[model samples]
Target: SRYPNDLARYPNARITFEHNQGIRERRKMRVNGNLLSSYQRQTVCLLGGVLQSEVSGMSLKLESPDKQVVQVIMKKPIEEPLEGLLEVVGEVTAKLAVVCHGYVLFPPGMSQNFDMETYNRLVELMNERKEHYPTMASC
Candidate 1:
């Protein structure tokens, strides 16, 4: 009944819903400082500790899970005071800097218990097994 014309033309034909693959492909992939250059110009999610902020509040230094420090440039002046750990959604530039589109600040005290080395290992594992885990491949 959904496709009345198609049903009328072929009464015995089966109808099935097809998912749009493009939607899943558009999700931002998670990456660390070491992986930034490889995903240049691509939108991605990066989690890091805030090392320093510029006086203009348009940029800051982020220490990635791998202990590499990279610059993060915001599309707009930062409205909130940045501290501790933050997750940035942005595109990687040619210079390996992240041009932030948006970001999420972790709650106070959360960073004290966070383990960077373990998280880095997990990221590497997910990337290595991307083919086997279709959902994680997008992260």
Candidate 2:
């Protein structure tokens, strides 16, 4: 499939494919060093819980630990029946950027935070709530 031109509005931008069956994603852009060095991948890991919530329910509300500094509530994608996993990821990332006002944080120690526990938890959670995921119109 051809890449979407709308993504070209941002330089160095690449399409990220969030496969429905797994956490691994195929990135459209080339990168040096370990691919895991990429910020997008790390962001995806950190937001696993939040994303799961969105997929499981009508909306997700994120807040800081203290419930003061940060608070973001996101409704499920208005564009229902996403084309596929690619579209699902693209829309999720776009909405996340908006919620963060485009200034995302990547703590130095966070990349490896997508440990087995977190991954397994996400899988379990998503599986438990599979029926709530948006319907896919077509692949």
Candidate 3:
């Protein structure tokens, strides 16, 4: 009934509908340290090695796979000692720092032989071709 004549004309055509909940959700993009400035004010996901952590200050330093380091300001003080590789999800600030919403810590030795350069390349490719990746597409 919604498309009476059109559905009859294209009998085999498939129709897909998307529902919006009236809330705008920002999509998180995977990024490296060097690309932080470009995504200022936007939320992003960063994978890096924990360089240093200041629990008192609620901040920490991370070194990306590309070897670029950046500061991450946490929403709350760290409750545990963070080490090894960490994946931080947060919004980027004007000063090129991330205000972390949450993080995941990879177990030690897991990242001991991790190849960062290749991973960084993959991130770049995914961002460059967001349309090809359904998860990355805005739609």
Clashes of 2: 0
Please give the RMSD to the true structure for each candidate, in Å: 13.4, 16.6, 12.7
lDDT of 2: 0.28
lDDT string for model 1 (1-139, tens) is: 5333523543433222224344235666677788888788887778889999998989999999988898999767876678887777777995559887666566555667789889888777766776764431212
Highest TM-score: which candidate? 1
- Name the lDDT value of residue 44 in candidate 2: 27
Residue-level lDDT tens digits of model 3 in 44-115: 878899899994959999998778888999877887788777877778995458987666565565568778
Name the 10 consecutive residues with the lowest summed lDDT in model 1. Answer: 10-19
**Per-residue lDDT for 134 in model 2?**
28
The global C-alpha lDDT for each of the candidates, from Candidate 1 onward, is 0.71, 0.28, 0.71
Candidate 2 versus the native: TM-score? 0.20
Q: What's the true lDDT of residue 116 in model 1?
A: 82
Which 10-residue window in model 3 sums to the lowest lDDT?
15-24
Clashing pairs in 3: none
What's the residue-level lDDT of 129 in candidate 2?
66
TM-score list, all predictions: 0.75, 0.20, 0.74
